[model samples]
Target: MLNGLKTLFNKKSVDSKFGIALRSQAGSYALDKGEDTDIQAGEYFTETSESAGDWLDDLLSSHNFQGSGHLVLSASHYYNVQINKPDLPDNEIPSAIKWLVKDIVPIDPDEMIADYYDSPVIVSGTQKINVVCSHLTSLKKYTDSFKRYQVDLEGIITDEFAFANLLSHRKHSTLIICQQPFEEVFLIIVKEGQIYFSRRLRGFSDVGGYSTEQLSKGICDSLSLEVQKSMDYFERILKQTPVSEIKVLLPVKHENFIIENLDKNTNAQVSKLDLPSPFEQMRNCAASVGGLIEFERKGAEND
Candidate 1:
């Protein structure tokens, strides 16, 4: 199933040329480009028409940009689940997952692209594998949107994996709570450089016409409960090390309020998420930054 999808772009050398990384949400898109390890340029825009292809053309043409490269799309149209590692050959794992999640997933197995990440740790001959699936129809929509521009898609990755890539260098167990405008908050737990658990919660973003204090309180209350649940599950169900710290990534305007409120509610030390050097203004572009980092890491591995 998804094994073929995962290997679709491997036939090409990732470092042969430069590429563009794109993240879209709520009719808006952000484009990023880098040469070698340095990000040289970035652009953010909103679509005014139904045709995403037309919008992309206007953006690239307006900036006089040209070249074909890998496209990394940041989307939430995927599902992540944990399952026990089956006692089967590597080639049979995909079919096993299809059968396992056929009823769990809304769409038919034939209409989905599926992949999985085996837990870095193997305990008692059992492994926790994170399964990721995206609908074929949604994938086609994204591929078709960029095909008009002759862009080569490197991969379509979920925000969790992209964000995990951004935090790949961290050696400690940590909980990351990311609040994005108009999108569900992503609560991810990472341990030993791998995603241990992940969940998404709604009602954490801005409320139209609501006061800043009111919105902050609502977000803090909801976030507090989710954070506590994640911590308890990590320490009890997973029986792993306790998370050392809780990192919150949100818009700069809400950082101070969130820090103040979240600090009072959670035992873990809460602080703003630190961005990599090239992402100084990444408050609203966290996922895009992560996607760029993931793309670069893949390219380096290929090289």
Candidate 2:
């Protein structure tokens, strides 16, 4: 995902554009023509090796992603940090605050592609914003490939925004946990269709391989602690109202076991996320499928 490239969509263009989810090991595609999106889409993957650059050309060179497109870099490729808003003009925010992001992510500020989304007013009436930082060298590998192959890159997003798009507008906040197989878990809170908070929880990448036996053995109880910690920060620290719902798009068969345990242990209700239409069926690539759906707003709003 690159900065300063985004498009507003028309109904017909949804079929022409492509949505891709790029991870360390694989790339999955989705088209928004209603049902059978999987039939219309394709993916490029490699398991034995850990390369991510030109191999993408094999996937991008096809007619699949021809026009303007959107891409969701999986959680491993990027990170989000919520910090106090900098008192600067919009044009200066990137340079002024990228250092702040560096303090948290440990990357050289020059080589990081950073962007921000404003969070809700904190309980103390202080303004806050979330900064998404990606590696410039790593991200340009894919974007340069897109340019060489003539795919007009529109917008870049993460699974946090992609998965949050599935929720229907609600009066109260809902926290959603999402993962695709070996990817890190991402937690996001949405209410009335707006993203209020997001976090990337480490470990648990192999949750997709978890069996009924493993979940029943309580391998996922630490997940409750992560969920509770996030809820606590949102309620007690941010001073926001308590989130009452928890949904998951984790794409595992035994996901229910984790959900059941979370429901019993955590403060809010927990359930498996009910993805919409085409995404619901392709649970593993739900975030890529969601890229086909238009964003409620740009991921980096300060731009």
Candidate 3:
């Protein structure tokens, strides 16, 4: 019932791709066409349920989104984790680990739909992989809404992969830090343009709104430590080289302060990701913009 939740396409899709980055109380619809993009954004009623789809229905109508598209869900919609890759074959791993991680998630993993992506290549006994899952019943509200709005739901990706798509792939590893509205801090290491490792810092929802006092009083320090520690795990545990760069893409006002903080505590050079017009205006939808842009983030051929 829940399929195509990840990047399963191996070929080009000619039809228009509608990429929407969904947050708890609002979202942005992005349609990227090489040189130009048309973006529409709206906020949901504060008192409504996120799964009710009324806000999404309005957004799609406003965009006139009538074709297949990808949905990049925010942290609140799904469960994401890193675990030892099961010894089973690639095709069988999803089913096996679904049961393995059932305990961590609130949903019945047996009934929930799941997908996985490769972690960094560990030259050791067992490799690690990242698993993402969403309950089918809860996800249906999105699919059903798409059907009603005439927008074919092509696929769904977590916010990690969505942000990863915004980067230009380099041979070396790059760690990215991003945050959507009211969502926790997300850290991802993208190696060779694909997701190698990802983490969501709990209790950090909306760090962008942290006041100058909050940032000065150890919040940025804590964030720097968290990022440094994550990089350490990737290098020491995964047996990978130190990351080449660290990029921060956020909607916060004190971007330079965060960058400066990370720069002081980390070996990698820190900087902000450059965003174009619409994206800069609607920073909350950067993931949706990532979802729309065709960067070779999944190791797909650019040709």
TM values, all candidates: 0.80, 0.84, 0.86
The lDDT per prediction is 0.63, 0.74, 0.74
Q: Judged by TM-score relative to the true structure, which candidate is superior, 1 or 2?
A: 2
Local accuracy of candidate 2 as per-residue lDDT tens digits, 1-303: 335434322222333656788876877877643335333555668764346775677777654556555789887788777888988898888677678877799789888778887886664677888888888788777777777776766788887777876777698989998887667888888888778778878878887787878765766777888888999988888777899999988777777777888888887888888866544577777777667654323423534
**lDDT tens digits by residue: candidate 1, 1-303:** 133554443233233222343444432323444353434435455553245445556655564333323344443557777778777898888767867777877778889778777877555557878777777775665556445545555665667766676575667788988754555677889876678888877665453335567756575677688789989988887777888888878754657676778889888888888767756675566665665566567668888
- Which pairs of residues have clashing backbones in candidate 2? none
Model 3 C-alpha lDDT versus the unseen true structure: 0.74
Tens-digit lDDT track for model 3 on 112-209? 88877776575477777777888778667776777776666667777887888878868889999988777788999998877778888987776777
lDDT of 1: 0.63
Q: Show where candidate 2 strays beyond 4 Å.
A: 1-15, 33-43, 48-50, 123-125, 295-303
Residue 12 lDDT in candidate 3: 40
Name the lDDT value of residue 284 in candidate 3.
66
